[model samples]
Structures are given as C-alpha cells and as structure tokens.
Target: MKHYPVGVFCDFDGTISKSDLIASIAYEFAGQAGRDLVRRIQRRELSVREGVEAIFRAIPSARLPEITSYTEQLTVVREGFDQLVSGCIQRGWLFAVVSGGLDIFVHPVVQAYRSEIEVFCNHLDASGEYLSIEWDVTCDDLCDGGCGLCKPTVLRRFKPDNDVQVVIGDGVTDLKAAKEADYVFARDSLLRVCREQGIACTPFESLAEVIPTLEQEVSL
Candidate 1:
C-alpha cells in the first residue's frame, strides 16, 4: 500500500454546523425585510451578491455587534466533528477551513479547534451597527464560476504534489472544489449539483460518516 500526504478542506456554514451562522445573523440583525431578501436569493430569483448587499443594507445601524454576539451563542458545532478533526491531526494531516462565510463567524469555530486547523474566509466591516462585506473572490479568476472565494483555487494552491486532496461541503459554491478534489464528500446542494453534473462524489450526512472512509483510504 502507498502512503500519500493528505490535505482536508471543509466548508464552515451548513457543512460543519446544523445551520448557516451568517444567514442566522442576517435574519436576526436585518429583520423581516432582510429575511425576505434572503429567500429570494436562495430561490435564485436574485443574485447572491446583490441579495447579500441588500441584507446588509437592511441591517439596522445599532445591532451589528449584538448580532455577532448572538451568532456566537447560537452556533453549534456538528456532532463528531471534533473527533474527526482530532483523528486527522493525530495522523499528521493538513486541515484547513475554506468558507465563503464571514470571518467573524468562522473565526470562533476555527479557534475552538485551533491546533489542528487553519481558516481562510471573507472579512467583514462593521461601523456602529451597520455592516459591509469584503469578499475574497480573486481565486475565481482561475476558474469559470464566480465563487466568493473560489474554493477550487484554494485547493489547487495548497494541494500536495504527493497526496490526494479531499473536500467536504454542502452547497453549489462547493461544486467546483468538489470536482477538483481527489475525494469529495458532498451533501445538500453540492450533492444535487454533483448528480446533475455527473460528478462522482460520496454523499455523507456528517463528518462521522466520512472519518472511517477516509481512514480506509489512507490506510490502503
């Protein structure tokens, strides 16, 4: 059997948690009008970028930090994620978080598992109680999809010459990276995209389901 260096990249929002933290924050801070806008974007009736901008615009000028604090309180890490991350680190695997979500939300989660993972995400700018987004889309120039952070580009950059690359995600934005990875653990929108696009992927409900499969792959 061959032993290859392995790198694991995961999406933060719906993948690692039961809900989308940023979306929850938007709902709380931006109120009903903002929630309506989010629905439109999710339905593809509006561009995601435009929808996000609208949400931020609707967010009040006094609840930004409060919303941030609320997010920290509401966010829950997925079951068994800590064990999966620990297992990977124990085996000397390189783990990274590649998320389109804001850094404010991603930071705390990554910090919880700090010694084992690194995070790359978009930044947020908040003044008083209003917020603006700083998108990291430069990686998209290398690919056709106008992704927020261009997950595939991040994979290509950090991909090891001697090991297989693995990506775990659950949305359309994750599809590009899923295609680029040697192994893709997909669910939700990403799984649907893979099926429609005829991309081979392993569907998983959680990281717990992925750990054993990865262990077998690495061992072999």
Candidate 2:
C-alpha cells in the first residue's frame, strides 16, 4: 500500500448527526420564522449566514441554556465517527469537523472526541436579550457563499502540500469545500449538486460506508 498523507474535512450537522440540528433547533425554538429562514436558505434567497443569524435572533438569550441542553440530548453522532477519528490518528491523517454549525451545540455533540479531532465553527452569543452569531470565520475573496464558518477557507488553510484533500458532507454548506477537494464523499443535496455540476464524487449514506472507501484510497 502506498503511503500518503490525507486531510479529511467532514461536515457536522446532517453529515455527522442523523439530521440537521440547526434546522431542527431553529424550528423547535424559532417556530415558523425559523422554518421560513431555512426555506430561504435552501432556495438561495438568503445566505446561510443570514438565514442562521435570523433564525437564532428570534429566540431569547435566556433560552440558550435550555437550547444547549436540548441539543446535547437530541444529537446522535453518525456511526463510525469514532472509528474514523481513531483511524486518522493512527494513520497520521488530519481529520477535522469543519462545520457551518454553532460552537455551543457543535462542541457539546462532539465533546467525546474533542481532544482527538479539530473543530472549526461559528460561535453563539447570548449577550443581548436575543441570541446572535459571532462569526469567528468568514469567506475569503475566493468565495461568495457567505458561509458563517467558511468551510472552504478552513480547507485551504488546513490542506497540506502533497496531501490528498478529502471532503465529506451532505448539504449546501459543503458545496464550496467539495469544489476544493481532491476526493469527495457526498450525500443528499450535496450529492445532487455534485451530479449537476459534474464534479467527480463518491455518494454515501452513512459514515460507516465511508471508512473502508477512505482507507482504500489512502492505501492506494
């Protein structure tokens, strides 16, 4: 087997968890307004940053603790996540969860592997009466997506020279990262977009299926 360095940048929400926690929490807390914002995001009527900001802005700051608690209880990491993280560490591969999700909930959900893999995401602020987002990362000139955490920027910064850039994701948030990847593991909307754009990719429904495929790629 050939020895090569690999960088795996995976999405958080829908890809890691069984569902999109952002949307789930939005609808649960923000109600119809949250649903509208999410719909606008899907239709490209609003940027992901804009939509997410509006969604959270609807909820009171006091609800943050409750929200965090609910999110932790509700989140379920995808199968093979730990295995994948372990494999990467063992193989000297870089595995990071680069998400458009918030730090509050994202951190709690991935707390088990907090010391293992790197996580890049946005922060949630409850300083005022209503919650707001604090974007610690943003899109560079090369991108126009207005992604809150800017996955592409994270990918570019972390992707090492001569390393295979692999991206795993399942939504619009992953689109720019896919364009930057040498290998892509896609599903759902991201899969459809990949097909439409003619971007070469491997479609996967779960992370379990991704493990063998990724291992084989790096070995080759």
Candidate 2: tens digits of C-alpha lDDT, residues 95-206: 7899888887778777887886779888889999999988867888878767868988887776654268899999977888999998999999999999999998999876
Best by TM-score: 2
Best by lDDT: 2
Could you tell me every candidate's TM-score relative to the true structure?
0.85, 0.93
State each candidate's clash count.
0, 0
lDDT at 176 for candidate 2?
88
Give each prediction's root-mean-square deviation over alpha carbons.
Answer: 3.4, 2.8
Residue runs of model 1 more than 4 Å from their true location after superposition: 1-4, 43-47, 160-162, 217-220
lDDT of 1 by residue, 18-81 (tens): 6887678767777888788778766767755667767876766576678778878888888768
Native-referenced Cα lDDT, model 2: 0.84
Give candidate 2's error at residue 8 in angstroms. 0.3
